[model samples]
Target: MDADETGRPARQLVVWRPDQVPAQHDVPGPGDLRDGTTTGRLLIRSLMRAQLGLSLMCLAVALTVTASFPVIAAMVPAVGRITVAGLPLTLVVLGFALYPVLFAVGWFYHRQARQLETRFTELVDPPRPEDPAAGRPGPDV
Candidate 1:
């Protein structure tokens, strides 16, 4: 603390926590995997792993829907019909309900795949400096 020119005490600035480290990758984080730097290798791996996880999830949902198809079909004849939410029973159970959910899950995987490819392209294609005026060290050195 210091005395103000008017004689009032001036409170000193206090910092409790240290400054936060900068992000490792421009993408969302696994949190500064070493000195707050995200490398290309890590970026590729992260996107691939995430995309793979979504694929697996979609696959699992798809399998569940497929496996239940026979059971649903068997009940249709016995029950005569069962419409749901204003859709025909057969169409609702097989085409609209089951397949749509699977398609959505698959679409999520597809979107992730596109994002990974885009990011990978950015990692591979970067500006080069070969032109003399592009700032190479002169031969005069």
Candidate 2:
């Protein structure tokens, strides 16, 4: 229940050092911004590229596993017995289990990335003002 000099939470006291105050850059007021708009197409493109790369890697792994499961099964007898219940262990392990879990993980990652992007866009792009000078008639007549 400790309060600091400013009556803020104790966490605020941690930042009350005697050193020089951090430089305060002038915040750009709405009037100072010219043609204000949040253009994040590059960020969107980067996220898409990242997801594409992930999908490509996942496909590569799938292909490699498909080409090698038979050889592996031939080498190790235990590879044939990896079941979780009364089902064929192979069906339960590979078909019922691994793929769904992999897909869920990929989906979770994509969703989290998208949500983070949305939060970033909200933070970095503050609201724009309705420009008073936008539709004013020119001083010609």
Stretches off by above 4 angstroms in model 1 are: 1-48, 69-81, 84-88, 124-141
Cα displacement (angstroms), candidate 1, residue 97, comes to 3.2
TM-score of each: 0.39, 0.38
> How does each model score on lDDT?
0.59, 0.53
| Candidate 2 lDDT over residue span 37-56, tens digit each | 23334445555777677667
Report model 1's TM-score to 2 decimal places: 0.39
TM-score result, candidate 2: 0.38
What range of 10 consecutive residues in model 2 has the weakest lDDT sum? 28-37
lDDT, residue 115, model 2: 63
